[model samples]
Target: MPQNKQIHLDNRPTGEAELSNFKLVVGETPALADDQVLVRHHYLSLDPYMRGRMNDSKSYAASQPLGQTFQGGTVGEVVESRHPKFAVGDKVVGFGGWQEYGVVDANQPGVLRKVDTTHVPLSHYLGAVGMPGVTAWYGLVKIIAPKAGETLVVTAASGAVGSAFGALAKARGCRVVGIAGGPDKCKYVTDELGFDACIDYRQHPDVKSMSAALKEACPDGIDGYFENVGGYILDAVLLRLNAFARIALCGMIAGYDGQPLPIQNPTLLLINRVKLEGFIVSEHMEVWPEALKELGTLVATGKLRPRESIAEGIEKAPEAFLGLLKGKNFGKQLVKLV
Candidate 1:
């Protein structure tokens, strides 16, 4: 029997997650039953949404049970299978958690699916062509519904979802502006990703200053906004919103640490008539096939460029996730479990 190394949630985090909250253990892989497949993970996705799962309170998804393997998306290859649908050597992507291997049931709907690595890389599926890409697509194409010649702004501009959102908006002939944490990220957002402008949020001391910078970047005012990091960034964007603008509320990393980070300008939504809506990507699986097809083509053709910040091993996942919450990562954060 092969020993499987796994990382489990040792304790629920009250504030920011600490390294002590997780534990690594080695276990034996069980014999495959009928309609089962054993997968050895190659890449594990470390996303901000996983932080919410660490809390004991109710959320869109269930709280990760203590002493269980931390839940996450994984891209891997089938090592063994008793299922008729899957065979050995099959490459798959699924919610396999933070482990070296996963035994997945083939009967579960939307749990496991094979991926083609011929056009796009395997790791790219976890970033650009997977959840993040579909997230960008949903917010941009479905929610924001931006028209050509409009101005669109996205927060966390250098991140996986935000970068893809900006690129997709630019492709639609919209002038896209990104708001990132630092000068380096701002430069990459504008120069590399081809955003019309990028505002370094760190350069501004307050929302007033940040709003002015946003006004300058978006001369026509923001017609569509893809919100990722909320709080002050949300307030700043609200202050500059054009009438009848659309806002896609994707994430709020500011309050992920169990802090009380409420929106300061709720009145803007009424005054500006902004269509602000929050969404969980998993709930909107209907449009995934359409979104993935477009995203995959863009990635394979080099039209869409999504970056990654990779950690070497499974043991490094906790630290990588912590770095992600603090904006230390450049793009999509991934753990190379292989």
Candidate 2:
């Protein structure tokens, strides 16, 4: 029998998640029952939203149970199957958690689906052409709803979702500006991702400084904003918002470390008549098909390029995840489990 390696949640983190909060165990793989398929994970996606699930407080999703396998999205291949829909060697993507192998029931809805990796890379499914890509689509197409000649500002611009949003917005004829942490990411956002401009938020440590920089970059004001890293970035963007602007509130990574960072200028929302709304991507699954189609095409055609920060083994998942929360990893953070 093959040994299956799994990481479990050992403790609820009070602040930043540490290695001690997780426990790894190796065990014999269970036998497959009827309509079951055994998948060996090739890559595991580490995302910012997983941080919210670690807390015991109420969230969009249920709190992860202690001792249970830590939840994550995985791209894998079927190694064995008793199900008619899946066959051996088929590539698949699913919520397989932090495990080397996953047993998926064929009858279950929204669990597993075979993916074609011929045109696009298998790992891309976990990032640009997958959930993160769909997340960018939902926020841009559905919420912000930018028109041609408008200005769109995205926070965490070099990240998977933010990069996709910038590329997609630019493709639609919008002037794109990205706010990232450093010079390198800002360069990638403009040079590689083709944004109109990028602001290095590290240089401007305070809201006042950032707002000045934002004011210069967005001379016409921000018509739409895709917020990823909130706190002061949101404050800075709020000050630059055009009348009746739309803001798609995504992950607030700044406040994820147990700090309650409130917006200093909530009045801007009312004064600017900004349509500010927070959204959880999983809650809106109806757009997945359409979003994936466009994202996949853009990626396959070299239009929507997404970068990756890959860690080599399943054992490195905890470290990679911790690094992601701290913005230590660039682009999409993934663990190569195969």
Candidate 3:
């Protein structure tokens, strides 16, 4: 039998999670059963949604139990396979938890996507060309369906999904406005990603002022909103939406920190007949391949750039994850595990 180190949920968090909330334990790696492949985890993807999983509360996914290994998506190399579909040395992406080695059932959902690194970097498959890529593509092109002349607003605009939304909206010929925390990130959204404008939300005093800033940048009114942080930003965007406007609610990062949900601009929605739709990328799995293919082409052509906030080693995952919740990461947060 082999051995591995795994990180488990130590206790349910009260508010913000600290390193004490997780426990790192070394144990014997479980033997693979039929149709299972053992993998050596190379990278673990730390996302904001995982924060919801730490508490014993109702959510889109079940809350993880105490002492159980906290689950997450990992990119790994197959070390052994009892299944015929996978062989040793195959590079694949799947849910491997936060461990040095683990067994994965081939039939499980979110199973490995075989990676070909000849065309792109392996880590990117976990990021831009992966789930985040698919989320941006489908959320914008399919969900919002912004037209060339439309104005699009994206919240948390410096992060991976938000950045993708802004950049892809720009590529589709929409006037894109990004809302980021600071000047550097705001500049990155405008100067690097080619957004029409960017609003530094941290500097703005209130949602009304942010709304006014958005209005200044988009005199035509926002036709589409690619929302990442919900709370007040959503409220601000709601007040500025044009007639027949579309909003793709990607992730509510602001509300994730235990803030109360803000009320919507009901009168505007009623008058404008705006369309606001919320989605999880997993629900629309059928559209992922086509979206990834399109996004991959964009990356190959230099039209898109994927940003990553990489923290080395599995032990740093908890810290990295906490940083993500605090909006410390600039892009996709990843843990490089060896």
Candidate 4:
């Protein structure tokens, strides 16, 4: 067995997260007990949702435990297995957290999952074809169900969830418009991701400016919205929504660090007759198979080409993750542990 390096939460962040909140330590992957499987993680996913988990506050999920490996997702290969269902060298995805190695009890169902990397890249299991992809599917299909020819808008448009939502919505023959921060991301959303239009929110700092931009981009008015970034962006989107627009509230990255984000004129929801629903995709177990199959097919067929920004090692995870929270990473944020 080798020394396993892991990052643990030492304290909860009071405002914005700082490096001091997490401590990196060297530990060992203990010998596998009966029915235990050991996986050597190749990649660690860094997502905005994990930032919310870092705080000891009431949320959709419990706060990530202190002194434990930071909770997130990982894709790797099983190096040892004592269980009948898993074998050595099988590619797997699991909630491996911020560690080089993860041990799971195979007796627990859904603790780890075998993945096929023949068509989809192994790292993508943490992004486009995995939880992020499934999240986009559930939000768009189950919540904001858009009809063909209707206009739909998504914020954080070049990130994992937003990218998947764009591809999925486009396939349904809807006009997909994306909102991102800069020229590069906005370009990728329209050029690579095939969105009908992309709005650069950086060019429009205030809700008034943002609404003007949305008006030009979505002249038909937004019929559905995939809300990844809530704040002024949500306020701006509200102004352009047509009557009876649907909103799938997936993330509120702007307020993840205990910042207050009061949506101005929330009465817009009433006036628009909008169906706004906040969702945690893990709670919807029934949609996984259907979502994964569609996302995997989109990736395999090259219709949904997702991009990634990967840091080199586990030591860089914290910095990379902080960059993710600030929208510095270009695409799906990840750390290559191996």
lDDT of 1 by residue, 1-338 (tens): 47899999999887779999999988999988899999999999999989998998877889999999999999999999989989899999999999999999989998999999999999989988999989999999989999999999998889999888987898899999998989889988888889999999889858999999999999889999998888888898899999999999888888888887788879999999989888888899999999999889888888888889999999999999999999999999999977
Q: Pairing residues by index, what is the TM-score of model 4?
A: 0.99
Cα lDDT of model 2 by residue, 82-187, tens digit:
9998999999999999999998887898899889998899999999999999999999999999899999999888999998998799889999999988889999
For candidate 3, give the lDDT.
0.83
- Measured on C-alpha atoms, candidate 1 has an lDDT of 0.91
How high is each candidate's TM-score?
Answer: 0.98, 0.99, 0.95, 0.99
| Candidate 4 per-residue C-alpha lDDT over 1-338 given as tens digits, one digit per residue, 9 for 90 to 100 | 77899999999888999989989999877998999999999999999999999988899999999998998899999999999999999999999899999999978877799999999999999999999999999999999888899999999999999999999999999999999989999999999999999998899999999999999999989999999889999999999999999999999999998988998999999998989999999999899999999999999999999999999988899989998999999989999987
lDDT of 3 by residue, 43-71 (tens): 89888888888877777878878887789
lDDT of each: 0.91, 0.92, 0.83, 0.93
Candidate 4 stretches greater than 4 Å from native: none
Query: What lDDT is reached at residue 262 by model 1?
Result: 80
Residue pairs with colliding backbones in model 4 are none
> Least lDDT summed over 10 consecutive residues: which range in candidate 3?
257-266
Clashes of each: 0, 0, 0, 0
Predictions: Cα RMSD each:
1.0, 0.8, 1.6, 0.7
Error of 4 at 238 (Å): 0.8
Report clash pairs, candidate 3: none
Worst 10 residues of 2 by lDDT: 252-261
